[model samples]
Target: MKRIQIEKIFHHNAYRIGVFFDKDFEVIAILKRIGATYSGSRRCWYLDYSKASYHKLRFHFPDLVVVTESSNTTLVTGINNRDLSPIASSSVLQLDSTLSNPEHKQTQITSEKLKLQLLPSIGKYWVFKMHFHHEISKQLLKIKGVYWNGNYKSYMVFRNETVKQHVEAVLGVGSFFGSDYFTKDLLPVKGKIKILPHTEATSWMEVYVPKLVAVHEKLKRFSLARFSKSKNCYLLPAAPIVMDSLHLQFESTGIDIENLLPKNYLDKRNLPNKKQLDLSKTKKSLLDMVPVQAQTYLSSMIDTLLALNYSSSTLRTYCGAFIQFLRYFEFRNPESINREEIIRFLGSLMERGLSATSGHSMVNGVQFYYQQVLGKVDYSFVLPRPKKEKKLPVVLTMEECLQIFKVVDNPKHKLLLLIGYGAGLRVSEIVSLKWSDILFEEQKIHIKNAKGKKDRMVMLPYSIVTSLQLYRELYKGKHYVFEGQFAGEPYSTGSVQQVMRNALKLTGLEKKATVHTLRHSFATHLLENGTDIRYIQQFLGHSSIKTTTIYTHLTKTAVDKIQSPLDRMVDLKSKKKLEE
Candidate 1:
């Protein structure tokens, strides 16, 4: 028996909120009451409840004058706030008392009777009850797997032949017959059925037919309801049977339906069961399950790699990448995507005006979103990153670099440029540096929470020691070494870039160089002075030796040191001529 109750009703000027309760007195429905508010000059308004019953109870009901047929499903219009749980549960008793006959029970009102009454003019195929199920079945039928139909419900089998035997023993031959009768007599007229002869005589009959898919799906929902009630016990009569069914289906077909069950729904840990988590809200609004917000997806992805508490800059970069992915696909729903779609999307990005390095970053960003946040497997083949071009790192000459240092007038700005170039720090790393990170005695700076969130130390050159000392005398802040022009804020990367640009213009050296060029010059000059490539890589905080190799081409040290074969031969001939 299904019992529905009205939990609450609130009336406003032209709107209301109605809450409903089920047989268990659990809140099952929240109805939005929409009404018309019109001035004397406005058009007339009408409220319809015929279709609203499928979702929830509302404040207004359809006018009987317009829908005169009582068989069209009665609408409890304009109902005052009342608790209907007890009334609905005792519907049979009240109904029986009204009829004054034991034979005239509420159970006699089968799906056929109610269906016909609701739409008497329609054919059997157009039965209202069948129509409702057919619409809802569209979602359930998408699940391709093996399941069993109880008398009026369906359940996906998990495993265990013993559980099947138990269900069969309890059900007997009536299992098949009951299922058939329920489908033909109680279900909508258009519904299909499959009846089979008993195979083992336990209680179940080996029924095999595709039409049973719908029945199994509908019954599965009812079984979930039962599981929700029995918080701390075996889920069903045949747990082993359900389990074995899932295994058998998976073995025969590659689809793994068992994993499709929400992790929070079933608890297998310690083999213990707790009160089932509320899935009604989730089930009712399937759209909410998708990661609609880019921030939500990015936030979740970052939590897996780093702690949930990450810097705001890290959060923005991760989220921006994810959002760009969604925009590239025109914000297509993730459900519509597959491996090939991702492959094509990544491939198309190559010619869409993005540089190879930028494309590589995008691939990493999109890959992390799907594989980590979405929990999708088989993404290894989707992301095909483009090859980066091999090019020498741009470096400034020592004279030009000195000229830039001399041009910067602000003491704090001068120190920032010196450190960024001096220590080979990324723009982000420069902003995050603190006063305590510097160790004057050791002539090193502790780069804590650097790129990839790893900690490392960098050398502090003696040349810049005096400059830093002078800047500290002027600024004297406790935390950040490079404080913004405004009192307490850390200087941003934009501000630093502006400082570098202004310095370049003032020095009259405009070769289109960035703040990073200073670090490149530092590396190139160190290489020229005979610093090992491996040492340069560590000092520059390179994750790979390959990244540091670009500076080798710019150093000119190797080429300058080489004695060309032509030069040796020319020198020998010249010496012979002189001797002759």
Candidate 2:
């Protein structure tokens, strides 16, 4: 077995130690037995300054070398101190050459220049005066029992030998000064500010400050820091300028700023808050807002969806739609809400310029909530949904598809685009693929738990087999074929869409096409090549034949083979002229 190398150094008045060894689990067990705990922040194991602990560590590892303030000396038992050169007085400790050295490791102690003055401030506590830099400031803040004194503008901690040793180990030994020795204040007061949504109006914001400080004074000039007696928080008008100023001020003072506004408040402007408004008086103007009582009902609806094993996207859509419906009733009891109210609520949505597709979603979501969760079936007939608009899928030609593939240079992105088009797979299906899903011998790609929670198999394009093999080798140890930055998770849908957008820009194609368009083009091309409609239907995973028939209109196979009657009539007239 290879020898284990351990480097021991005194840092921040504590004995900081690190152990490097081959894949030997025994050494780890030994370190754990010694009560050495790992520090993620320091990236090492440390012990409190104790001479007895140092002697015990040397006993365990007979060949250990301890670097001390004296020189580059070996602490091993029975080793002679002859022929050792005394290092510079500024140097701390130096380990053997075989040990791995960190690039930013400090070789000399510069704490003498670090101006640290400890003095008695109040009963049982001592105040410290020191110039703050990045490294020293972080170390001082990390010391146990140390806290910032806001009034004195300095740091204070309990007086103890352990604490003094830790501070001296980091900032070096300092002299105790008289109470009035230092007068300048270097520390600044810090506080936390929380901004939440106001219940009174949409344009109003609630600011919660634990204590009135300089931040509160700065906020008063903008007429945004009025104290609310009822809420016991500061109330301000929600505006871009107000938010921007608060963000800048809190960030500058090193204060923790927490903004807890609702998604609607952050996304939209000029929205009227319905809390103070008498929304019950106006039935037609009832918008789809979340009601207070709707939370319990929405939770039950979500539980039902999860129990039924619905997809995450479907659950989010259903919950959002139901929340809107419940908000219209102002969170009234769901059992008391009749079908007439549901109809009125959906009508209000349409009047507010909701599309037919959105109207369908609202109708389905409400129906599922009432029928599935509440066990009501009679109200289904009363909630009539609008007809879905008939629209054709955008299909790119073979030449255009080739142009897209040519423009994408990234191997992973190119493979994603190819699989989308080559196998007629949806954007969601392509990203969720794993290494186990690809079957090279069978020439099939298994799609499990796809849309509608169904499973299907698509043919693997022979042309992309080599590229897939190369990609698998490049991105090893991935559960998903196209893994994200985090292991085991599928590639993000937005990233794939961005790749398509870039490719489209390079092709200079005027047609508005997305990643799904590649799948559409694949189906169209297969149909144009005389592939059976039944086969195309299975390939595209369409549940109904009617859904598959839409591609017939996009194909030119039938139209191109037929000759028009007007052209035949013109041919007869030309023949008669030639005979004359």
Candidate 3:
């Protein structure tokens, strides 16, 4: 006869009856189907404790030998084939006497009446449903890895040679019918949860497909999910509720949900299983990357930037530039490298022929380190900065922009370029966008916490709205408007630049342009169309009208209208030559 042990245990913030077994698949499956949840820590399946929960166990498996236990010893048959001790002997437990005693002699339900129902395994378990007396139920419960499905009123049991052998050895083959369903994966699995490296100490489930889009639309609907391109998965907030939600959303898609049990723990380490973050994506600290002598200064600088609530991009740029300065004074004291030495360092950087922009960034990075981080060090000496280059912003003609878009075949890539040229967004602003920022009803994108810690609204052209909706449906990007390879993270700034480069190459445009060129083109094209400079300033998120007016120099239509002196005086020489 099949044997199981039951005892009251507090779990899941409730009193539950812990169902113990000898790893019997059938008994486990029955318990699971009837709403029992498994606890790996307890190494048993559990059901909510109640009168119904207790009697329900016997309702299914009548012949099960239930041994109840106390806080003390739960000894069964000893080596001597007799009770070794009076105080720690095995106990045959009886339920509420009003219930356990049938009150009348019961007719035995025999195995001949139990017709085994079988089908191919849907996933790890064979799915089957049956209606039978408790005696017949005991026969099925003898099989290993069995679980009851309360929803379908079925017992989906494991089918394997190991389980079959266990049954034949424990109970004769004649005791229970062999109803086997081949174990195999059935559903089309489009994704699986992976953990990102950033969350190793406190684990998280990062669900990802092999490629661009996630398998289902609902995965993107998770409010707490964030996309990590470095890990190429949607990083989920570590919570049991999130795991439960994932199971509900992906159970039908079939990607080894049962195997992920270890990841769903409530501990800081969480997921479907306690999957740690990917090792490859773990970033080295700037402090670690710098010379050992300079690490102290770099650590202080990073802490100050974080306390100020600076954007991650700003923190990275400023810290990186400051690290270069620190490296120069690796042997010198950090406090001593402030005034005259800083200017000399700037001169050395200029002498290397770096860009005017790099010079400006380096100045700011160094200034922040001294003023904000060091607190009392007012290094106000005149710094030798590189002369600002006066080159105008590169602007693509409307025809050129259109030609590039036409040559690009990927819908995702095409939409990316169109947003760049049409929306007048900086490359940084574009990549930080989330789908929640889209205001389709207003036909504007709510640019949240943009550069300089300001919010602004930018137009969403009606022409690209359809494309945006279609892209959302096809990609089902969670959170971000232009999600990277997977949902959650905005498309990478590097990927956006690469898309621009690919388009320019395909269109054979030799013009030197970066992703920001699209923004310049957007502003210049608007100016050419006679949009007021103030409105253009708002569209470009420029704090000053002077910044917007730079587009005036780039507008071809305005420049074309003003006839040049050379063009006006051109006809006289040509006319004389024609007459001669």
Candidate 4:
């Protein structure tokens, strides 16, 4: 290589040009002379191929005169004649070199190839257009030459040779995506592929994010690619295999690419998968899975479940459980929940001196937290409820039942109590019973949307039917058999129980009998009449036969006492003492 002296440097059309020793720069080639601008800010020179290079050089290097211009025969005479020896050798060498070379070398850079792969795949293709600059990021399809036409809307690539050569020099490659040779359509013409870009640093790490993720996924197979502060914005090296697998999907499904990519610049390798989270939902402090507005009315969640035709008893159990749960949790939002937190909460319920029934409510509430609230229905850990005391239900005899009915003055209240005990109905089952639920013609009462939201039929008593007919004649309404004072609301279960107590007081029935005792009486009476235990189980809607079996112990045979074996033995010694 020969050194050329920089006599002068000047700018033309925002490009700097340099005039070296003996004006040998002009002897380079025909393409070099036609059009080019130079920038000489840092002593490093570059050319802008769209502008005239020589014209600008003439103004700065005025002291030198050009004598000839015949391809490689350009001659220049300068006033500085002291260094003719160095000038002669350098000038001759430069001329000989350019004249000897008819072709220029071209090498493709990996980054440019990557950019070509990324551009078409990006969903937000408009973002690139938003940052359009004439000379900075001009599209390859726009403009006649490599130079930008200052028109942002242009979409043509550089078609001129000199302009292409200029870009090749600056970018270290020429016509990457611009050429049809790399396209899928032109692979036949281009022959073998050159190279693919891969770096320890990910796309996000680079100052300019070259490839869109949609395209990157096609090029790479990655499942989880995360950005780390240690590696700046680039994807971390851990779990390369997983990320590769995910990338495959991204390539196939261009949709949801942005969702696959993480936003924060931190290692998220420990984070769970979409299906692997501990709780179906997170607590308010951790992550907001259920909307806050929805959680505010936690009771309404249960109500909605009911409205959607879930069992009324399930609604009662779930809502009651949730209410107790909120009290235990001090009415906090049900977010940021973890498995351990729930376990502790369940443990606390037993620790707090709550009954077995209360414990059941808690289990149901927490179960709902996982199922309905978090949308995670797969609960492996089960919270066992405390064992309820096996107490015999208080069932009044037929005479006692009649006594209470006689004392009850209110026709609706009396009918409600009579149906509860006489037909074996729960308070809720009784209140919710519509006129249509009563099948007097068939001597059956249909309970729809009962305990487990199940529908069942119960035998209607002849005596209660006659009383009901009399009551119906006296009272008329739209909905429930016993409607509330308000038009739509049904009579509350508690109100029915209170009315039962009042009727018992008036009738002078001394035995302790609740509205539920009426149901107990129905069950006990069935057993007393020798009805099969399994049949009774089905009638009462008990989940277990053991529940129905409890009524058998209340029967006269089960309740009757047997003489002790010790007492049955003869007392001969005591008899002899008495004879003496």
Candidate 5:
């Protein structure tokens, strides 16, 4: 499950908040109830900048991390006007003293005068509007609290008396007290650049140039500018110096440079390797290379799936198979394509090493598109389906399973393996297990939302109960019985697989088995110990008895009970010799 993140941005004289969530309906309903309005332009929700709005957000989402650009010193206090009387009065007094200074008279009457105007903004900040004069602007930019706001076309400074007085003294009162300031005319020649996260490993930046100002040839060449069709913007590799130059250029354009990029962008750790970067590029290329008509058909297929209430996983699988089918035919018109073409395509897939199960899935996707979407009843693409493989699942001997447990020293790893085998839980089911799912009193594991969205109860072995308690004490999981680094997040399936692999290697087991093999061993062992087939089916969450019967082939109970005809013949021969 994706965690919720609330990012508060000070944009266009208001606090624009963007929420990243996993589409939980209750959370969205809460946001709507709080009077937060969504903005299509910015792709986020917003409320007028105020203390009450911020508090309301905090109230609704108490645990969500709020990402902000402002420094700790400049954090908004969310205090009422009645509470801000002292600070307001002190600021007015400081302005009075700066205006009465007699020592600054000469410098005030210079040829090119600087003008500063302060306007009250949201929270404890003031918008300082001014025009650019080459010499004086440099001096103003050097101040710690002063920074430009691009969207507002003004500078922002902490509402502090000392900072305001210092600005007046530097600009000279004559230069600071003019009403002819125009921020639009003073817009920086070089435009804004924004760096954002593309993935965990990669970073991408967008270059938004001013209409009048042309991009510098040297900067463009150094950055190796490439246009991304998906983003509809030019992108550059997020090198450290390149990012610094982009920020410096935008800051020169008069935008405040506070936390311009994400916190992780500057860190020189776990950067994307060449292969990862190439894979991203390849995915983009494939998306862009898709023909327009094929994209239309793909969208129609997705819409149909949604209308029919198909599961998300099924929709994703079908769409992927359809995309491959379209690409194979160079995205030919779907209406013009015939059954023979689809038959040829399925044959081609087999020739290229596609498994029978995958080929069946592809056929289903195409059949759905034509029969359901196009309303074609006679779309007969009857190709010989490949025979399903009847290979028995690899089961670990009891001794080998014990050996694996002995080698896995980490308590978490041991518990994960033991639970998988002990409770006959699938890999996905095991990772998704929450603390509430474990009924300690009943000694049953409540396996909710298993395969086919069915829920069942499984026996929790008494032998591992103490071990489970110890692991829980060591990890202190917040939600999931096994949690990842982040609180409330489930432990990853990949991590569990790695633990299994390491155990197998340490035990020197040559069997081609995975984490699911533990589940297989559990069912087979239960069958060997005289467990009913119906109970085994329920334990494994199998929809059909035939599915559960596969374990019967691996069990030795029935075979061990039968005496061979050869053994009976040997007994008769021995008896006849004794009689003689």
Candidate 6:
């Protein structure tokens, strides 16, 4: 290896990188390229004290050692004839050999594979286009204003220095950052996919996501996908796998991808809403449902619910249920409306075939206002409610559960279903899961801040742990175990439910199973296998054993063993007939 003398010294009353090396013709040419100039008096080459020259020297001669003396007070002796040797006092700076190492070069090549582009502004948002990397995506998701721009196949963030810094830090150095080509490129007008109604599953599916480049790019993955400008839609050939994948891919992007799925494919059911039912942001406000005369009652009910620190879910439910009462008694004040009127309003809801759960919520909401808000004493007459149906939860048998698992093609979706049945997690709890919750040593998954704001530990099957280990290595999710298209938010329960619905279609199961049905199956199966209900209760994070014991009613393991007296009587009759 060769040596280059690099020293910071006063050159014309300013610091410069003084170079001292032998008069090799090739070395001189390289020094000249680094902006080095020869001083006739000192008889050595010199350049400005900057990093550019230092890097250039390394790039040109990766095998050479650089001895740097940056005391800033080091001065050269005038008219030195011979080459200056290394001074004992000056510190020796070794050359960077990593630049010449093949392993290091491979690392650079791997990192360089990830490229990014700055897309045109999407309304107020600045867009960044790149291939998704979990770690890089996680950092971007940390910014509060970042959005997954599905239309652009990019991330949209609010224009700010914090976002800019985060982007620069997360994405390593690249020339793409300084490029201007993307700015001039015309972008398509963004929109969402609209599925056209079709009768047959085998027929071509028509999608209307106008100029949505992301959708266009995705369509290119399948064969014979065409854009029909005449009909203002895109027509694509149908495949069940593609349909299921399409829903799973974009559903997490905050789009209602369920609507894009064909009805015949999913076998649609009147499944209870997976969303929180918060109507606060909807266009039709609860106040709008009531007459102008009765707006105050509705407003008061909401304000009261909020003041009481009721959960947002409860607040929405009460507001929704109470609004019906307000609209019915529009002419009269809430105080004037008695038990009979309240009963009549509920009766009407029952006539409309509202579910028992909804009916109960409506009753509880009205009761809160009358008893707490109005401070009313209980009258002799009871305020009536819809009869509470003792309906059994739908449970999938062990073999049936395997069938559903077999049909699930996506690994993440499969793991999601596995966790649901294997761990017995609720739809809400499953979505809110974070990577930090998984405990390998304890063999448990921590369910924190769950229903009733309580934390509990649930068993993590060895099978799930193995899958999770492989998945974590691949995805490396920082926040949630399963993230949505956007970074920080948990996977939407609705999306998981859609995945469940899609999987059931592939299997010929007639049961109207939901994501919750997996939880029910988990509990019932565990009970059948003789897992104590008390432990099951704890594992399920149930507040009461009664809630857990419901599985007992569904598990026919014990009941199947009991022989009927009629069977015994039939055997006796058969014996008598044979004897006769």
lDDT of 5 by residue, 168-195 (tens): 6666663333333323455444334444
Worst 10 residues of 5 by lDDT: 78-87
Off by over 4 Å in 1: 1-318, 377-381, 562-580
Which runs in model 2 stand beyond 4 Å of their true positions? 1-291, 347-353, 377-382, 568-579
TM-scores for the candidates: 0.45, 0.50, 0.53, 0.43, 0.50, 0.52
Clashing pairs in 2: none
> Cα miss at 555, model 3 (Å)?
1.2
Q: Which has the greatest TM-score? A: 3
Model 4 residue 358 CA deviation (Å) reads 0.7
On lDDT, the candidate that comes out on top is 2
Per-residue accuracy of model 1 over 235-336 as CA lDDT, tens digit each: 222223433443432232222232323223332221212211222222222223234653354445656534444444444445445555665566675556
Q: What is the Cα-based lDDT of residue 179 in candidate 1?
A: 20
lDDT (C-alpha, whole model) for all candidates:
0.49, 0.66, 0.64, 0.51, 0.64, 0.66
Q: Comparing 2 and 6 by TM-score, which wins?
A: 6
Which of candidates 2 and 3 is the stronger one according to TM-score? 3
Q: After best superposition, candidate 3 residue 346: deviation in angstroms?
A: 2.0
Local error of candidate 4 at residue 339 (angstroms): 3.4
lDDT of 2: 0.66
Off by more than 4 A, model 6: 1-284, 347-355, 375-382, 576-580
Question: After superposition on all CA atoms, how large is the RMSD of candidate 6?
Answer: 34.1
